[model samples]
Target: MEKEFYIDLIYKSFSGDLSEEEQNQLENWLSESEANKKEADVLEKTWQLSANFSKDFEINLDAEFAQLQDRIDLDEKGNVQEAIVKTMPTIRKKSWWKPLSVAAAVLLLAAAVFIFNQNPATAEMLAMETLEGEMKEVALADGSKVWLNENSKLTYPDAMNGEERRVTLTGEAFFDITKNPSKPFIIDTRDAEVKVLGTSFEVRAIDDEIRTEVVVKTGRVSLGKKNDLKPIELTANQKGIYNSKTGKKLNYEVKNLNSISWQNNMLEFNDLPLEKVLEDVENHFGIKVILENQDLLKCKYGSLFPDAKEAEVLKGISSVFKMKLVESGERTYRLKGGDCQNTSE
Candidate 1:
């Protein structure tokens, strides 16, 4: 078969515009060899994804056509170089049809690339959001998973179409990525970006926060600004912090065992101080915990509340420290008591 005929067949197959005879001919050709079948399968799947995305996202055809025209102009410029060489009678005499054949192939290949790229469409962007006091779980198209925290939003593509599986984050989320060595998963945030092959990690990029953070639970992650040349890399049980204002890699930490605790609906205090425990509680419940008596911050508490309510956690902490828990304002609570080493409970 001629190369142009095969290229046309592939293009027709991609668009699902192939006639019955053409489809049968293509199917027979594919079934002829394993390699051919694989190529056809890849093309079909990629085209399907693009076709679906194109339906949802209206492409700027005028702009896209303009870009294609520019590329074609560049290709024509290359043809001009071939024209200069054509002036040589000896080269022309050596092969009368060779130059024409070469030019045809070049133009055909360029046209194929431009047409394939333009019609399949760009990646289809999708998003997930959670309200205050709510959390959501998302299953990505690539078999990866995400746990979106309260008041957070995550934007991902319906299909990961390029060299990387990229998603944008606006608040906090825990990602459990599926392994795809050829295509690394990337989390894009306002302050920083996180890249990994197939890893589970937590990313926090709250709008008002002074810093954006990445806590890796498994595998390895590269964390820094999206365009940073040398982003800080982290492995399991490691964390990377970035200063939002300066866009600097602030620091790295080695422990983040409870990074995904909130996803499990569990609050764990492992020999944590009263001050830190309150901070965690505040973050988890979107509430403020204040110490009316400054000395109450000195207490070290250790406990676990699995699937516990907000009131239960407050009451538990108050009873153990012998502190008075009082509501001061909406979504705010105060701990009034003495400084005591309350590691007993």
Candidate 2:
């Protein structure tokens, strides 16, 4: 049988277009010999790469196949150079009349790459930005959310369809990422690379500043510096600070809410009663908080609730007080069943 039959089967397999019978035939052929398996592997890689290329440019498959056999390797200008594929017999045939060897398959991929990258196009970059005194909320395609602070910029692909969801940031932003263990989220900054898999955190990497700070609100975040500094993992309320000028990394528990309140609408308290915290939340987010048990109010609370959402602030307060948060009325939450005896600050 012509090798095109097997190559067709391999390409069909990638798109899940093969029938059970075709699959069986392909499998049987693959198990026939090591050479066949290796050839199939090469064909599969070529098909995938060419498929990606085809999305950007139309594929004249027959034309590509015919020309690829004639030469290999792209010049500095991405023009195909004349290089003979020794495996191809000198007796040329018509469009796909002859079977494609593994070398030809490899050459076809190279041609597609050169042709696709011929002009050397820059990647299409998309950006979301916030000006001075402006705060913007952006929802990512991956269900991740970002609250960009003033003078901040976040540039990312139209689709974060890679092994990792990556974006570049300049200035401060709070990210609430969707959990996908298979795909980690990465934030590239001037100083470090912050990686996470489903977490809520704030990253401050201003252009004019030498300090890059990451404060984790929930879940875990990995902070890796561009320099030789060791990476650090930050958990709930943990802060990681990297000084690019000093080449120093410092991580500690989050103290006072710093540089994030602009986006969070957060209320920072040194050491205040739960009642006072809720009072500030009420004023900040235009929400009211009711305590079912009066004792819960006496429980002192002081932690950063760096989420712009009103409910989240109340939820954080209730969690600290061990109270059940209930949205009893519009713009009002009732903290049900709580005690000061088990309170934590």
Candidate 3:
């Protein structure tokens, strides 16, 4: 088999593009010899590095690729292979990126030369990012489930073999962590960190963000600054916030249960002030709500909307408040002709 055939197949395999026969062929190739298996591993590792990498700058790609080309060259004529693998690196594109060119194949092969040469601690972990308006669910090696909100990024090891199951996060994600008291689950958000033995929670700490928050859905979470010995413990139905600018650590009872509504699109308000309720609605549907009468803010509302559309939810709220719903503009609304009342349901 031509070396490029295996390279293309390997890329397709990682991308889930391989048909049943192609998958079997790959398995057969790997089983043929340990050399084939080792080469495949290295290329795959290189593929992961390009996804998103910022680490050890020791091994220069040009120098390293030159060395690898000399060794891995199978065909007596190695000039073509040398030129293709010399292009710029592109490991990751989208979540499930496909093969690009022979150049990318060579890049992956070359990167693996140094990437796996380093110790496990120095290896660049895999990264996943969701674009805006896209949500993704990921399962970790430790059996934990992560529901990543749109515009969020998660960096995790290929396997959870350390004393602690650790991951780094940017943006927001709801975690249904697998319980493992021995190996606590830790999420590092640059300035802040959340340690958990086994619990479910939602964390929001954007890049260069001020407020690093964790809302506990189940179990307990220890929230604190990165590398800080002293941390605030949060229980279920609790929220912890560490403000980097103010250097303040705050713990509060979780009032809004639908804080993870992005995962399920469920809106739940428990006797919340009209002003606060509208804020959540606006955030979910990206629709701005205006109260024609400030008195409406005095009213408290309680309801549960299960997978309801924006229009349906707004109509329900209007009926409950005895108000008229007016569409002011695209993705904007006005609640007028309403009287303040204890609208609890």
Candidate 4:
């Protein structure tokens, strides 16, 4: 394939534009062999470097194009005619300022490169971590707070320098963002993007499903489709759950104000189904609980329990459901098969 074609494909993939087939093809091209993977890695790294580098420097497109043209000619092995034809589009957009602007931009980019390479520890520090069975808290340079759930990871700049504060995450996290009207805070995940000026929200992205559960604990936040368009604006006391794969969003009034109490060592549930409750417990405590009875899994319950020992919590759940709890192993707990006689009030 032509270099320009590959470049366009890369750009489209980054912008989330390629169709499923095209995406598969691109992925195959990227991982087909060792050579392809190396090329893709180089391209991806270059794109990342260009995206994050400080934009103070001006760029001279003409000079860069000229150098590229020379390299292409040499690599084409005397196919100068085909090379010129391939580069015609770029050649047509010539401007006198292009060369000088590119020179200035290159200088600025070089300085940024130097700074980025100078500090290895800072680069690692910018990455997010989620310990097993523990939530990791991060205090951003801008005074924003982020709580990353177990088995989660986030990446951000050590410090924000310019017009936008951007971060990438995998798994789940809760954000208590600092207000900066001039600079919008953006969280990018595999499923969707959450943007906020100042607000508190929870985002969960896992298993091809992206759920941005936003509750404006303080200010307003806007949830939007990542790499696509503007999201619906959510004010205080409003919540939105977005599913990226389906492109469906469910919006509702924020209920159960104690939703985030789990972060403070409290587990409060209001009309939550047993399955969801179990999911939360497993996530919070990092233990696996298996329900032997499928019917009980669908039952809904409401309760408040202190974030105490796992055994205590399990015992409380068993009492509420009138079910027997059997500890199978160190990390395994099973709710024995049973049915509740009288529902707890």
lDDT (C-alpha) at residue 104 in model 2: 9
**Model 1 misplaced regions, further than 4 Å:** 1-122, 131-134, 208-210, 217-219, 244-247, 254-261, 286-294, 304-316, 319-339, 342-345
Better of 1 and 2 by lDDT: 1
Q: Which ranges in model 2 have alpha carbons more than 4 Å from their true place?
A: 1-123, 227-229, 268-345
- Report the C-alpha lDDT of model 4 over 1-345, residue by residue, as the tens digit: 665666578878777788888778777677757877777788789878888776576766644554454344345534544654787686446342132221100000000000121223334337877877678998887898888877777677777765777777766677776767788777766555667655456655553333444554445556766555757765544455555434655444432434454555667565577888888788667799998887887677777675646778788777777778988998999998666543543
**Cα miss at 268, model 2 (Å)?**
4.2
Candidate 3 lDDT tens digits, 22-57 = 889888888999999999999888998889967766
lDDT of each residue in 197-282, candidate 2, tens digit only: 43566666654444555665555666766434568765554556555554555555443343345555656764577777676677
Which pairs of residues collide in candidate 4? 58-101, 58-105, 59-101, 59-102, 60-98, 60-101, 60-102
lDDT of 1 by residue, 1-345 (tens): 754575579987665788889888887887778888777678778877886663477876644654554455446646655754776564334231232121100000000000011112477777898998788999998998988877777788777668778787776677777778798777666556667744566666655444455665445667676578988765544445655445555333222245456766677676676788888888778799888777767577877787858999999888887888899999999888755755454
lDDT of 3: 0.68
- The TM-score ranking, best first, is 3, 1, 4, 2
> What TM-score do all the candidates reach, one by one?
0.51, 0.43, 0.59, 0.48
lDDT of 4: 0.61
Locate the minimum summed-lDDT window of 10 residues in model 3.
Answer: 104-113
Give the total clashing residue pairs for model 2.
0
Per-candidate RMSD, Å: 31.1, 29.5, 26.6, 25.4
Highest lDDT among the candidates is held by which one? 3
Cα deviation of 5 in candidate 1 (Å)? Answer: 99
Kindly indicate the candidate among 2 and 3 with the higher TM-score: 3
